[model samples]
Target: MNISYKFFSSHVCRICHRSINWEPKSPVSIASASRLYSGSPSPKNSKSEDNRSKEKWWSISNEWKIITTIGIGIASWFVNAKQDRIHSRKQMKMNLVSSQLKELYGPLYGNRIVAETSYRAAMKEYGGLRNYLEQARKERDAEMIKRWRSYVWTVLYPLDEEAVDIICKHAHLIAEKDFPEEFDTFLKHIARMRFVMEQWKNEKGNLESTKEFTEDDFLEDTNSSGIGGSKSMINHLQLKCKHLRKQQQEYVEDISVDNLTLGMLNKIKI
Candidate 1:
C-alpha cells in the first residue's frame, strides 16, 4: 500500500517513507552511467569521503621538477655572467689609470710640488690644489696645466722618498720636512763640480788646446758684471753661470739616446 509523507509527496511505503528507498533502484544504462550517473549525488550523501580521494598525496612529477631546476640554474648562470662582466670593466678602468699615472711619474712629480706650494701659499684658499692650477693656467694651455697639476697632486698625495725628490728637482718649492739629505748632498757635489769647471776657462797665452785652472782658482769671482758688488754677489754670479751650464747640458741629454732623463743625468753627475 502507498503511504504519504509530510516532507516527501506521496506514494511512499509506511515502513520506510523515504521516496528513494521505497521505490526499487533503476538499472543505469552504460551511456547514463558515464554521463548522468557521474553528475548524480550518492545515496550515502558522503561529501567528506569524496574529498578524501582527491587528497591521495602522490609524489611530484620528476620531469616537471627537472624543468624547474634547469630553469633556475640557467637564471643563476646569467646573473653570475653579468656580474663578471661588470667586474671586468671596473678592473680595466683601474688598470688604465695606473698605466697613465706610471707614464707620468716624472712630469707629475714636478707639477705636484709646485701646485701644492701654490695652494699652501694661497692660505689654503678656495679648495686644495685644483684651484691653484686653474689660477696658474692663464698663459698656458689648460690641458698641459691639468696634466702637470694632476702629476703634482699624485706625488704630493703621498710623501714617500721617491716622490719628494721628484717634486724638489723640478721646482724650488719643497716641504722642508719631506726633503732627503742624500739627494741634497748629491746636488751639492754636482754644484762643486760645476764651480771647478769655471776656473779652467780658455786662456789666450796657451796654444795647446786651452790652459787649465785649479779648484782653488775656480773659487774666484773676478767678474764685475751684473750686480757684482760683494763676495756674496760674486758667489751668486758663479752659481748662475754653473746653473746655466747645467741646463744646457740637460737640453742636450733630453734628446739623447735611451730617453736619459734630467733627473738621471743629474744623479749621474753628467
Candidate 2:
C-alpha cells in the first residue's frame, strides 16, 4: 500500500473517514474446475466426485486466502497509515502543549521548559553544547529546537544567569500579584500557605546573604583587598543555595496530594 505525503505540508485527507466496500462476486469456470480429476478410475462418476471434492477445497481455500490476504493488506496499510497520522498529530500537539504550558505559566515556565528540553536534547546529540558546536551546528540546533520549541521563544532563548536571578527576586510578586489557578490550582489552602512559607524561606536566604555582606563584616578585615569579605560572600552564596534547596524540599512536602492546602491555592485560576 502507498501513502501520500504532504509535498508542501498542505496535504489533507478529506476522505479519511469513508467506508470500504465488500468484494464483488464473479461466476466460476466449470471446465477449469473439472481438470483436476483427469486421472481418476471409473472415468465418469468417480472422477466427477473426486473432482468435486478437490474443487470444493481448492475453491474455498483460494477464495478465502485471496480475500484474507487482501483484507490483511488493507488492514495493515490502514494501521500503518494511522500510526503515521498519530505521530504527526503528536508532534503538533506537543508543540501546542508546550506553548500553552508556557503561556499559562508565564515566561518563567517557558524558559524553564525550553531551556531544559533544548539542553536535554542537545546533550543527547553531542554530549552538550557547553560552548558553541561550531557555527553550522549551532544554527542547526537553533533551527531544529526552534521548530521543536519555538526557537527558545526569543533570540536570547535560554535566560542568562542574571535573568534567572532577577526572576528569583519575584516571590513577593507571585504571592501578592494575581496568577491563574493553573499554577498548582488544585493545591489546597494549606498548600498555598505552605507555598507562602516556602517563599519566606527563600527570601530569608537572600536577606541572610545581604546581611553577610554588610560594611561591618568588610570593615572588620584590615586587608585592603578585603579577601575576608570575598570569602564571606562565597560562603553567603553557598548558604543561600543550601537554604533554597531546603525550602524546595519543604515546598514539595507541603504540596503532597495526600495532605493539601485550602484557601491560598483555591484563589488561583489553575
Candidate 3:
C-alpha cells in the first residue's frame, strides 16, 4: 500500500480535546493589530479629544473676560465714589466761604468805605480834625464844638456802634482764628469816644466841662492805636474782603470743573 503523509497546519490534542492552530501573520495585519492595542486613538476618541480641547480654551477665555469686567467695574465704582466725596467736601467749604463773605466781610468792608469817605469829607471841611478841635477849644467856639458833636453823634458814633454790633454778632464768621488786634483797638477807641460823648450829653452839652475829656483825648487814642482815626482797619477789611472773594471764585471754578469731569466720566461709564 503506497500511503502519502499530508502535512497539517492544525492538530488536535486527543487527551485535552483542544485544537491548536499555527497561523502566519501578514505585515498589514500586524500593523492593524498594533494600532488596536497601542496608545494611538480611534476616530471617535480623536473627535472627543478635540471637543475637550475646544471646551478648555473657551472656559479659560471666558473666565479671563469675566475677571477683567469685574475688575473694571470695581475700579470705576471706587473712582466715582472718591470723586463724590471730594465734591461734597468742596461744596461744604464753598458754602461756608460764601456765608463768611456775605454775612461778615462784605458788610464790614462796605461800612469801612462809607466811614472813611465821611471822615475824609469832614477833614476837608475843617482843614483837619486836629486843627478844628484845637481852634474850637482855644476860641471857645460853641457853634463849632456843637457841629463837631453833631457829626460824631450822627455819623462816627453810629457807624462805629454798628460795626461793633456786627463784630459781636458774627464773631464766628471772622476769618482769623483769634480776635484781631486791630478790632480790639477799635473797640477800645469806640468805647472811649462813647464815654466822652455821654459825659458831654449828661452835662447838657456844657462846652466848659468838655475840657475834662477834650477831642484830643479820643483823637490821640485813635491815632496812637491806628484804628478809627487811621487807615489800619480799613486796609485790613479791604484785604480780607478781596481775599475771601478770590477764594470764593476759586471754589466755584473748582466745583464747576469737578462737575464737568464727573459728567464726562458718567457718560463714558454708560
Over 81-162, each residue of candidate 2 has an lDDT whose tens digit, in order, gives 6655655554554444343323322444444445455556754755533332333233443333223222222322334332
Output candidate 2 Cα RMSD. Answer: 35.5
In candidate 2, position 136 carries an lDDT of 24
Candidate 3: residue pairs that collide:
none
Per-residue CA lDDT of model 1 for 25-119, tens digit only, reads: 56555545765557865544457666565554322455567778778767656655665565455445444434333333334444434544653
Order by TM-score, highest first: 3, 1, 2
lDDT of 3 by residue, 155-228 (tens): 87788888888888888998898898778877888777766665445456643334454555334332222235
Q: Which portions of model 1 miss their true places by more than 4 Å? A: 1-69, 102-107, 110-270
User: Of the candidates shown, which would achieve the greatest lDDT relative to the real structure?
Assistant: 3
Give the Å shift of residue 119 in candidate 3: 1.4
TM-scores for all predictions = 0.24, 0.24, 0.72
Q: After superposition, how far is residue 90 of candidate 2 from its true place, in Å?
A: 1.7
Counting clashing residue pairs in each candidate, in order, gives: 2, 15, 0
Return the top candidate by TM-score: 3
